[model samples]
Target: MSAVTDRTEAGAGAAATAGAPVMTRRLRVILLLLLGAQFMLAADFSILNVALPDIGKGLGFSLGNLQWVTTAFSLAAAGFTLLFGRVADLFGRRRLFLIGMALLTAASLVGGVAESPGILLAGRVAQGLATAMVTPAALSLLTTSFPEGPLRDRALGLNGAMLSAGFITGAVLGGVLTDLLSWRWAFFINLPVGVTVLVLAMTVLKESRAERTAKLDVPGAVTVSAGLLALVYGITAAQSDGWGSVGTLLPLLLGIALLVAFYVIELRAAEPLASVRVLKRRTVRWGNLGGLITFTMGSGVTFLMTLYLQKVLGFSPLVTGLSFGLLGVAAFVGGALAPRLIGRFGGPKALVGGLLVQGAASFLLAGIGGGSKSWLILVLAGTAVSGFGHISAVVSYMVTGTSGLPDGEQGLATGLTTLTQLVGLTLGIPVLSSIVTARTTALQATHSAADSVLAGVRLALLVNGGVLLVGALAIALFFARGTARRSATA
Candidate 1:
């Protein structure tokens, strides 16, 4: 057998021992089905990025208002993930997954035809909801389908690769479509992809329903999702509305209060959407914290780079998309290799080592930032390597963090993981953007606005480097040693 085949067999064996259904030949089709769905989700992530300028001009939106295009999608997706995860467990994975795809497809079509920012935002939000529903079910299905061993590892690795590939592919495709044709093509592109994936999924994906008492804690889901939405919206708004403004403070305060209430409700509620017990696992807690930091830095870096390429480097949308291809390739390669790396070095060592390398790369790139210096090659290459390191770290954490939980608790774990990622991305963007904006504004009198922006970019990179280092330290000092192996096979 090929390495992938051998690994799949081992994963099947491990999963069988866990009392998961044996992976039959038919079951393997699930991976194929999932690939298309994952690609659609990942690609849409950066699709609108390059089209921001076009979108603003077309819709007569200010730069500030245009940000809602991205923000709405992100917060909606994050806010709904936990709710969807629980619903999937309660109802059925296959059913929910298909429903999500259908919604995403319809929403994409609507978005493509939107003439106003409000209509576009609405469609994007709907798409986000669909993403939330699809993503967790995809992960949960993989966990249940693949057995615990080499096969499972390979499967997860491939899953991660597809995700990374989709992200890069989206950037390039979105840029090309937007530049050559129109921004509308970016949204319209998902239509055919979604339709194809939906059809394939219906034909190939197996159905799995919760075997135990599949109760959903609606209160827990509502509170948690609403809290996250408030918090993220508040932060994003802070960039425009100012921290002291009621628009920012009210949402921020309410978000904190609602989140606190969520914790309290989870503690007392029977049939909680996310069991409080999962957080008790030292591995789960620390892993999630680490995930949060990494994701935050990762998203911030991407946002900064996207801006820099277009505004500073004078790269057209197509070139900017092409430039980001390096990071995407690195991520794909890293994800594809993660299973072997985990089997060899173990997940703990990989986690710490990856974070450290990523931090170093960020610092290196930041150090090389000067508009006169032809450092794009060096910086891009370093960022790519950093992406590689991050991929391994993420996949290892994901597998280990959810390890050993009862099948019933799997949805909770998925929900928590998604929650952390959402919170991280939500908070990270505005904080970094605000920092850069503040720094640039402060320097506008002293230097050209363009130069000030570059300076701000460099500062943002420095800060991200520091954040990555601190996150690495947290993994090494507080979490890595214990969870490395335990969580993998838990």
Candidate 2:
């Protein structure tokens, strides 16, 4: 009997050892497909920037309405993300993901062949809506598939790297495609990639939904979606219309009112779209705040740097895009190392440290002067350093934000995190651009145009760095206190 038991145990051990590699391979495949979908969605946000002029010309878009091509996408994506995220949880994450991928592929085809501005705009809107469905669903799938530990950390790190790489790659590819082929290629390029991902996903991905589904929260969804749409529109419009203008204020106020109403509705709902209790968690709240700070300041500084490169140094669009290659490489490296850092220092500490590093890099960039090619070296160094820190912070915040939540709430948590990212990206450039414009206008009376522009860029960079520092300090203190309380209770 003893010999028989020994043999059974040995056989079980051998089988487990043999299956380890197979499990690892499967996880890798799943990660790749999930990241691929995320990368496509993220890249779409920036892919059309360089191709915009060509699109306007080809599609007969007026100067005033051309911005809508991008704005429409941003508005739909940011507005509907939270609603779709909850919907994905209640219904089916895998189903929504496939639907989104298919819609994105079809929308790309429509936009690629568009002969009128209206047709192109409709396609852009569809792409945005598809992205809203895809982003949270893919993230929720990743979080649910990987157990909470170092493995999950590594997956999220790769996700962060892919997101950064996608944005940078989009800019570069947009220029190359526009200059070499045509702007239509910008839309057409997603075809093969999307179709490939869709095929692989259907085979490799498993279906996942909340363990206990609840009824759809229609009122909560409507109010939040409408509010977000109005808010995003107002923020985007502020770039052209002054902040105080009726166009901006009316929507802004209406959005706020609707959002407040949504919250009130949520407090009474049987199953809230976003659980107030879950949102009150220390990690979720502070982590999201940290995400907002990093994305807003990082994107704002990047835009200012772009203007400095193109407007001040007179680099062409393609050259400017190429110059950002170093930043992308640094971000990739940073993301690769992020899981190790988090394992060593824990999420909160890593997040604070990343913010500090990013802030310091922004300060270094604030030293740029006017009319000197030498500043290019500083620009490259600053961008590279900031990119590293920015990706690290991004990964840390995501890990922190989604940690300590149940499988059921993963979709909602991911939605909130992604929403912050979208909001920050949408609002950062316009807000900072307004400040720079005001400052430049004021300085134009006494300074040369180049000097005034440089001054504005420098000032914006300072604000960017300052805000990062403040946010880091706040998060560090909050987390420190929470840690103390937990330790005491334990």
Candidate 3:
């Protein structure tokens, strides 16, 4: 695929981009396959949220074990992503991508036909692992395919938009399919898409790998995967088990221990799965930090709003999904504009502005409770603004994180990018919900149930906004300033 372009009139910047990768007609096809994989994986994260009730009902899951429907997927994703990133470098990106897609196809089929909770959970875990394998390879391929310039930024922007759209669509599509057809269709839908991506990818893509790859770091991979899995599980457990309980604290502590061991192992290993040197770069470090905040706050608002709409406002699953779909549209718009914004304002400036927008929106939402349908305007507006902020930050931070890596390291770099995002999203729920629960308890002691929920939501929104604002400032001061200019030139 030739990515070369004719841009004589695009100004001096155009000439500067001439040396970047060129795409022929096949370039578009390659991009579609890559972005399609991205959309599929991202959608899987939220698609099942709406289908969970139906799935649980059909499978006869107990309340205690029910959450595994989602958690199993999360655990596999968080745990295996980094390992698979390194694997892509050592093996081959295209090979891994195709394998991952095939895995996803099989997983979807298994999930769709599952007659038992165990089978369904197994399918979800397989899907998560498959996603972990695919994401890094796809990101590596996309980033390497388009060299750094307007093209790369635009590509990343579009990729971000597709990701946002898929996430938003999943929330809505799950309900629509579940209500009209069956929850099994949620899994079935993935089957065709996954297979198509795999087939097209086979035809449209060439194999790629590190020019000088080394042996895989088995210990580092195992320790890190186990460490992340344990930690993520602990973070999730904290929501239901209480942050201070043994169920939460024990695995958390163990996870901490394993992670410490992993770091130690990496420092000594000749070829670490994830290079400590690359991670030490300021952009990589801060980008992940900023990404963590953006993703956490952005996903946090959606999670809270979903609760408010369903529990407080008594919206049906379909209505709730459709309501959030508006946010998705806004997100795509923001994503489309991210390239121009980054080009004009630079990544750091854009990152700051985006975070600020999200913070302000969260603050505005604090007082927006009480299930009155009249409040829909405020809800939609707040969510729309927040979604814009999120997509903007998402693109900016991804560029920041992956910039300057050699081709061989791109997989590891993107793996880290994905790891931070998934972790942030995974953690957002427990952290924000905990605050809301506490406030709701305090309010319920004295106020009407509806009033208490409203009060609780208001307080939670305040905390969410405050934290985002703080995170924004931290990113601005610590990560954004000098790199923006350099990346622009790059």
Q: By lDDT, is 1 or 2 better?
A: 2
- What tens digits encode model 1's per-residue C-alpha lDDT throughout 272-295? 777778878875787677678777
Instruction: Summarize candidate 3's per-residue lDDT along 292-322 as a digit string, tens digits.
Output: 9988888888888888887788889899999
Deviating ranges (above 4 Å) for candidate 1: 1-27, 371-373, 480-490
- Residue range with the least summed lDDT across 10 consecutive positions in model 2: 16-25
Clashing pairs in 3: 2-22, 2-23, 2-24, 3-22, 3-23, 4-22, 4-23
Runs in model 2 lying further than 4 Å from the true structure: 1-23
Looking at model 1, how many pairs of residues clash? 8
Please write out the lDDT profile of model 2 over residues 75-142, one tens digit for every residue: 99999999988988989999999999999999999999999998999999999999999999999999
**TM-score winner, 1 or 3:** 3
Q: lDDT of each prediction vs. the true structure?
A: 0.79, 0.91, 0.87
Report residue 137 deviation for candidate 3 (angstroms): 0.8
**Clash count, one per candidate:** 8, 0, 7
User: All candidates' TM-scores?
Assistant: 0.91, 0.95, 0.94
Q: Deviation in angstroms for 195 in model 1?
A: 1.4
